[model samples]
Target: MSGNIAKHVFVMAGTGSIGLIAIFMVDLLNFFYISALKNPSYTAAVAFAGSLGFILSAISIGSSIGISATVSRLIGAKKRGKARRYAATFLAVMLCIATLLAALNFIFSRQLVSLIGGKGEALEGAVLFLRILAPAFPLLCLVMAISGLLRSLGEANAAMRVTLSGAVCAAVLDPIFIFGLDLGLTGAALGTIFSRILICANGWYQLSKHDILAFPRLKEIKPALKAIAPIALPAIATNLATPVGNLFVTRTMSHFGNDAISALSVIERSVPICFAFIFALTGSIGPIIAQNFGARIFERVKETYRWALRFTLGCVALIWLIFFLNQNLLIKLFHIQGIGIPIIHFFCDYLVEGYAFLGLLFVSNTAFNNLGFAFYSTFFNWGRATLGTIPFVLIGFYWGPEGILTGMTAGMALFGTLAYFKAKNVIHNLHLRFPEALA
Candidate 1:
């Protein structure tokens, strides 16, 4: 606990906290921009916002994973000086990449949203959201890198503070800016960006205090990148798949009209809360798995995986119980009234059914990703996103929004089965290969 264990938790807590809020940020955006949520334009805005956030997420995951991997490995190997050097170079590279990303995003905010089908007020709203949110990129990257470093170092408690700060900021500002100021969707985006900025500042301060922020240096970046790329790339690929799946979901829903799309947006924003326990489990288990795997404590690695799976699945099951008992009331919470009632019943039923299928898929993919089998995780997602699911959604063009949900459920149920089988194979193989590890 004094060494790698502490550092990993420290980073994990901060990263997970931000991750949790970031997961819910979509809802925050909608809550603030109530009109945008209902406007076909708003759906597009939501799509664009989701796409951009995800793209950054992919980049951040890739960059941070690599950085943390390289530094942590060196530290594990007792190469303290080398670890420091690696951390310094990684901070420089990631900051530059994040800054340039913000700039590029600023330039092409409108165009990017347009590709995802944004038009009219939604497009304008998206541009406003992106333009405002773009500048936070550098800070986000820096903080993610620093936070990852801290987690790698076992200053997890500090890292948690950084994320809690962002979540708290967004949580508080959501009501004040969105409802109070009536800033709507833009207000939500502002609150989220503001939160990220705050985390960035805090993360940077901690990172610098720990001497991880040695920017303005050009030394050894290539080697550092090389060291981190293998580990990070898979995680990035896994991260990118969410947006890819989102792109199709957006396209399919839009066919039913703006209102249908809007309803879909609401569910997307809200459903994650239902899966919170599983995600928290993944965050905690990943570093434990990573460190144990690093140290060649193979038995403990397998044992941890089993415990994580059982533990997560149990929590998910309990959540499902609560959801089942009060789904009607839960659906009512969105207050998706007014014109939103168009496909409201459809959404309520869809969530009730689809959540059951997604339960297995979501937890399995998370466990795989955390187990460092991220490429496998991404493959499952890519299958769901592009290959098997798109055809199912298209079959519903004539049926309207209800058909879209039905088709989506069908595709996911099919793909979720596929993911489940693959995960079983993985779990089976691990158990067999390391019998003593699990013992």
Candidate 2:
């Protein structure tokens, strides 16, 4: 907290990126292994399953954001005891919610898969994959909550290791299960389950070592719920917007053919790998902003936001260049064929730059989520997902899959710009409210 704001943003984001990229890399490799089976049905099935999994993961992420933001603020105020109680209570709450969601998703796996247009082998494979992996939802939530607590305590490396361990576990197990065991799609699901278990173990160990967890009393539960819900509910709604947007894209792509769906899957997995740093920024910057805001250091909070924006732009530029140069390589790497080829080509060439704006949106989201305007995050995200998305996508639908992608990019640019301005306004309002902080 006493160091250079730019350095802090860079260091935290860099270390945080390592773990996030590792996990995403593993996920991309999982898709690669599945694609190696030479079955579009398998690829498409995994795509649908992945979309469904993203929704569940969103819930965990949203809940973790609330836990992290609230606890970090308390810690900044020197209320360590309250922070620990909040941590433990939020963890328990998320566990129960995760369990309930997992059960429902597992029971209705087929219907969920079919709702997004899964068919034949794709339908069967997706259903089996979802059912096999559903039980791990609670594990995922626990790991996320624990990681959040570690980050709130400034244990960035420890938090990174929580995910890094899981990535390594998935990396080693995926090939063996998918190829060596000849389990195909089922193997991938098993790999994911085992990986979550490893992550949960690592996170708990790290958090325990910090003494940041304790079992909450019954009375503590009510207050904890009140503290976390304000942020979490909106944060969950915000996070859910992306998947809801993707759901539209996936459902629409299904109409084009398995080739389009497979291409979409490749693109989806490729994004986090390419922009992992940008994705990491949300988690990495949250604690920094929250702590400063909590301490009433208004200028540092604003400075952090600016530095984060700069870092995001630089990251996006570098990633875009790499993707543009390797467009063909990506297509070949994924063994994309037919309509999938052009779709990948177009995304690498035309749509890559849109992520700059998306990065802006993410920076703004960090501000909104941590600076007590969580509802703004939800509003903008849903606006981007629905108004920013649906109409543009429908217009682009006339041109084909590439057109649909183009429309999505437009929506990103629109909401991202708006959110950036809104976040700046939010920070300015903080100064007005606490003029003494400025003095």
Candidate 3:
């Protein structure tokens, strides 16, 4: 049992390392432009636009979640053919959804930015960015489906490579387009689209090579859609909560001027970089748990949860220490000036501690989803978004930018604690009822 868990972690971590490097490299490149521009309002605009894109792109992942859950179960039941069918179905669904989303992005780019409280040059930049990236939504969705498919098959390394390839491509292109070509914001968006196309193509090649991915026949589509919809909707909703909550946070930050909004953007982008391992652990273990659960190996399911939480929290601690010890150097790396600097400082100093609890929340969400308690994860997250975020953010509004971070920390602490206990109880009850199934 120990050996298996260790192996899964190792694979997951290896993928996680590559993914982290890729994500940070892309984000850092974007920030390099922001820093080089040395304009707070411009930074805020880019961040706001980026946030809109980020939130919308997340739904594609929701589709992948449903696909992953289905694939894991099929694999656990030793139903390889059915698993591949779902993979085909996933591509079909993602393509359809991505088309609609991309159209919306193009049509309502201005309104989308406006709704997010973007205005002036910031709004203009956001509209340009979204429009430029709009067409790639389908490609992005397909990439997500492929990655989730690979992870379900216990091919985290392959999935990581696909993601890394995109990241490396984006990082390489970002500088050339943004600076070499002097395309400015459009360059950034184009860079992103090109990289995503690369990822999608690579993913398709792998899936086709494995004979696992295909365009579904009309007949195969309905049943596959039926199976995925139930899981996908709630899973999507669960994924939506954070970004929805972030919308509120971003809107709140907007009132504090471009500096505050830009600072929040910087931190948001920086998170995946700093806590990539935690994110990787959360994703990597979901399939492991789901496979065990599907096979009725309740003990292994429970063990994965405990080990994952421990491993994730440990990563958070180590990251926190690193961030704390070198906070000054890290701050300088962003080349931020004026208000953004102080805001960044406050985050590194005090709010950074909250990440441990956030790690707990992430692991708990994965556990719930993999354990067939998708609604529970959804409820907990949306509950946090509303009951947890609104009140704390309101309270923090009184203290300015630093206070917002405090409010965020408070909300996550409360919700994260509750989620941990709820998941613990759920796991305990499962073991109690299925004691004889502990194979």
Candidate 4:
């Protein structure tokens, strides 16, 4: 756990440099060209194209998550040999899926972008970028899942190295491709794909270093699939909402006009900075809880949950304050505003101000999501987005988008608190007896 703690933090902090800076990398290159992809049409095109990419990334992420969850479960059962076999199966399956998708993208890039309403040069660019970017899906998916398996076995340091290497690769390649090769958006996409391929290779090599490499026996595949079914499959589908929701938000803002969309884009990109740490913290906690819970170590599970909440909320608050203090300069940096700052600043403030509660929501959902509660996590997240967020967004039309932000703050806060208490009841009945907790 301590190794997981230290290593996950290091890699995530480094990934933040590239992941958080990605939009800027695109925007900066665009700014240099200024004519390549900065117009309203281009903005729309990028938004739509990127949204599709986001959806793809989400699917990949969810698959990785499921892999991590499944592999961790196997590790918890002291089935290292079995875990390795399942890892191989997952690896093989994901490689095929990613390869097929890349082929489809190559065959139908224009159609995929157009189906999502991408237009003009944007559509043309989207085609080039998507085809170039398609192979990354498999690489990222396979590596993330494999890394989870490694982390599951307490090889956090090695897993971190793989994730970090991907980030470093991206950071180094972004400037080189965009500036040196002049590939523009396609360059950014290419850099990302190549980086993931490298990461996948690194992840594979790391696994080969495992004390005992166990090959999956064809015989046990069925039972392994059955055990994994509860965690892996639904996760693949349910995690689609992230990119979907972002698309909805992007489309809604776009309807307001270009400035609205651009401002929202910058704001969305920036908010992830605050979330990066929170994400890392909750994510780090998930596997610990997942493994310990599977083994019925109730006290460790409970302690980890409590400690995660404390650490995450505090981390969220600290970063939220930084965003608050620098709001003016930060808002100005995007250079995309037209009287949107007040609204945008309010959105940021209200969004982060409500972090404690939302962090509660995040931790709870992650707890369930990590521990084979996929349905609950999915339902709550979708519900929160639909029932909780939509109502506020509707109200925003009447009051202002800031009204929507307020509503978001309120909704996330309320839902998070309610979810924590709700989960508490189940937590009580989690079928574990911690004699240590009794003592």
- Best-fitting candidate, scored by lDDT: 2
Q: Tens digit of lDDT per residue, candidate 1, span 316-419?
A: 46665665576566445554544456565655544455644555566567657755577667777778776656788788656876776677778777877787
Model 4, span 4-102: residue lDDT tens: 444454454444334334323433333223223345444445555566766666666666666666677667778877777776766566667778876
Off by over 4 Å in 3: 1-11, 20-25, 75-85, 287-303, 435-439
Whole-model Cα lDDT per candidate? 0.66, 0.87, 0.79, 0.64
Off by over 4 Å in 1: 1-47, 179-182, 287-307, 321-339, 342-344, 350-359, 362-375, 430-439
> How well does model 2 score by local distance difference test?
0.87
* 335-360 per-residue lDDT for model 3 (tens digits): 56666678888887777779888888
**Using lDDT as the measure, what is the rank order of every candidate, best first?**
2, 3, 1, 4
Instruction: Provide the lDDT at 342 for model 3.
Output: 88
Ranking by TM-score: 2, 3, 1, 4
Q: What TM-score fits each model? A: 0.81, 0.92, 0.91, 0.78
Number of backbone collisions per candidate: 17, 0, 0, 0
For candidate 4, the per-residue lDDT at 414 reads 63
The alpha-carbon lDDT assigned to residue 395 of candidate 4 equals 69
Best by TM-score: 2
